[model samples]
Target: MTTGALPTQTLPELPRHDHGGCINKAIQIAETLCNDRGVRLTPIRRKVLELVWESHRAVKAYDLLDRIKPLETSAKPATVYRALDFLIEQGLIHRVESLNAFIGCNCSDHQHELLLLICNRCQEVEERPALEVMNAVAKEIAEAGFHVHRKAIEIHGLCAQCAALELVR
Candidate 1:
């Protein structure tokens, strides 16, 4: 992470509330986005998207394959990978490079940069739109005569719950 180029504005911490509605809302958004983009949300892709939204935590590719295998007897690694790739390309999900996993995109704003926060203790992941951060980085990159095609920041730390637990001790 570059210091001088990054924006200083802080975003509100993700809420530790029920995420059932979040999952449902994400699915609806995915459907609309895919349709608008003239992409097919095939059964495999839809299921994979659902699995990715199963939690607020990032899910590894193999883990997703294992889960889907039981349902589809002929499921293969390539099948799940392709579905994951499509979802990512559609902005319905994000790939956490550091974790080699995928998580549902919590933001609906198109073309906005995302910042992922991972809680080490609980493995909870939060996705946020950090436009200011993106702009600052873009400016720096442009100054260097380079264009940023895409960028995402992944930060690992304890969430409020886990941090509070540590404080009590």
Candidate 2:
């Protein structure tokens, strides 16, 4: 984890890579956004974001709590939940409904439809900003007489690398 200001990772760069650089970029964006909105990026909140972006896989709140204990001795379930809520509200992270876990947002520049390509074999997730698809879905939902709110779509399958590995074996 970074001890000071976080690094910046551009949107175009997040999809095909997972490393310390990507996490740092996300943290920097979150920090800037919070600052712009006059929201406090508390230590706990920052830590929660860091933990969520530790890998491409989504992280459960309880698992986040367990990880926080060593750094924040007094950390509780509620505390972690609050941090998760804050991150979600800020668009710094997203909750995976199917998996019941959270993953860092790849596109924090603006609100758009997020499509997560989840690799079943490796548990890796890649974020795709699909505005056109989201708009079409919204139209269909409206035709059904339902109002729209937040949008997240998850498609589960093997990523290219994993699929290739399977073919090899």
Candidate 3:
């Protein structure tokens, strides 16, 4: 709805719930929504997202394999990898390329290009759909006659709590 209109709410300074409970609710909600949309909530996909969501830090796929059950020969790397792809496609999670891992995105609805602010200390990641830089970049691209499909913006820095700790020292 923000194609041209101002945002309905100021972006949250942080998410709105107990971390543990919020994540659990997000997964359950995603499952039910997927079911209603006639999408398959396969066991492997659920398990993978759960494993990623449990961590405040980005978690590697191999690490997730360890957290979930070890795979049998019948299920090769592609099985879990494909599930991760689907999860990302659905906007239920984000991939941190620097870490070569994934993190759960707790958005209740679909959004445009993602902008992530990652805390180095706590490793907590927050996703926002800010269009400031995105719109500028898109305008530049259009001037050059290039089309942009998908974009993800990641800015790594200390969060509020971590910044306060630094000030005390």
Candidate 4:
């Protein structure tokens, strides 16, 4: 009932578009961008991106490899890792440091900071746009003579649905 809260009723999944379309479009867009930037969107690399975009949940590399099993059959560990590195450099995905996992990004065009809201109980991860908060933090750090080259902001807590369920119990 409160703001930023989901109802107590358990939902199988969050609101999602047609996954087939989502993945396909994401691939097309990423490929287009890579072409524009003169980056190589190799077959293995494209497969990795597809695997990450298969779900909204955080996906570990091992699991990603498993999902893209065909790629694993041909590509070695180094190959997959290198493909992941390329995708990361291109900003096609976001890495969840706490979970040691990767997730496809909704923000594919522009660059911005992300605040991860991870559920301690269910481990559901939500990405909240964190421009203002990160900006403020950066300003404070700058005043303290600190500079940040990279940031993976994670705020762990119960999700709204979990909180509602707890209240009911």
lDDT of 2 by residue, 55-159 (tens): 887777887888899999998889889989999988899888777888898576757578888766666678887878888988999899986676789898877
Tens-digit per-residue lDDT, 3-120, candidate 1: 2111213322445667789888998998888888888999999999899998787788888988899988787899889998899888889988777788888577757477888876
Question: In candidate 2, which residue pairs get closer than 3 Å at backbone N, Cα or C atoms, i.e. clash?
Answer: 9-25
**What lDDT does candidate 2 reach at residue 60?**
74
Of the candidates numbered 2 and 3, which has the greater TM-score value?
2
C-alpha TM-score for every candidate: 0.85, 0.86, 0.77, 0.80
lDDT of 3 by residue, 42-90 (tens): 8788877787887566677887766565543355567889989998877
Candidate 3: lDDT of 144? 95
Candidate 2 structure, TM-score to reference: 0.86
Q: Which portions of model 4 miss their true places by more than 4 Å? A: 1-17, 165-169
Runs in model 3 deviating more than 4 A are: 1-17, 70-76
Which regions of candidate 2 fall more than 4 Å away from where they truly are? 1-18
Candidate 4 TM-score, C-alpha based: 0.80
| Candidate 3 pairs with clashing backbones | none
Q: What count of clashes does model 2 give?
A: 1
Candidate 1 Cα deviation (angstroms), residue 121: 1.2
Model 4 poorest 10 in a row by lDDT: 2-11
Using lDDT as the measure, what is the rank order of every candidate, best first? 2, 1, 4, 3
